[model samples]
Target: GDSVTQTEGLVTLTEGLPVMLNCTYQTIYSNPFLFWYVHYLNESPRLLLKSSTDNKRTEHQGFHATLHKSSSSFHLQKSSAQLSDSALYYCALSDRTGNTRKLIFGLGTTLQVQP
Candidate 1:
């Protein structure tokens, strides 16, 4: 019963504010690939950040996060939120070894930014 969890389903905020979407996960496997994907309405989910090795943080496209097996979490954080950054975000993890193609996705966190 391994899975990923995103606590926030909807986040509404004004422009120029900070935003943090909580992400906690659990997996029986020792090695897991934590990922963050951004989907801009009608667009496909794209890779944002991925943890290649534990404790080594990964970041891309103005977003950053690290997979911590000790805490069993990979939370996304950003200093200032932008109106254009508003979109549906997902915290995902790909299964280990032979199941690399399989991804466990959270329900998804929707962010709404107002100018």
Candidate 2:
């Protein structure tokens, strides 16, 4: 079984501050694909970044995350936080079960950026 964890349920930050959302995962598979999905107020969740290679950094939409196999972590980070960056972020792990691939999502973290 595979599972993802997002330590922060809510993160509040002022504009221009650095942002970090902790994400960690555990799986029996040797190589697992990790992903970060962003959900806006009324929009469908979209993929922000994904990586299967260990120790490689993936970036999208001003956010970046590195997959660390040694620590089993894929923490999302941004140098500066903006109001537009506020959203619900989900950490997910890809799993393949009997020719089908599915994603296991975490509880999700809400990023609230204020002016």
Number of the top TM-score candidate: 2
lDDT of candidate 1 over 16-109, digit per residue (tens): 8877887888887778888889899888898887876777777776677877889988988777889888999999977668944588998899
lDDT for 31 in candidate 2 is: 74
Q: Which stretches of candidate 1 lie over 4 Å from their true place?
A: none
Where is model 2 more than 4 Å wrong at Cα? 96-99
Q: At residue 111, give the lDDT of candidate 1.
A: 90
- Give the least accurate 10-residue stretch of model 2, judged by summed lDDT: 94-103
**lDDT tens digits by residue: candidate 2, 7-66:** 668899999999999999999977788889999989999999998577888888889999
Error of 1 at 112 (Å): 1.0
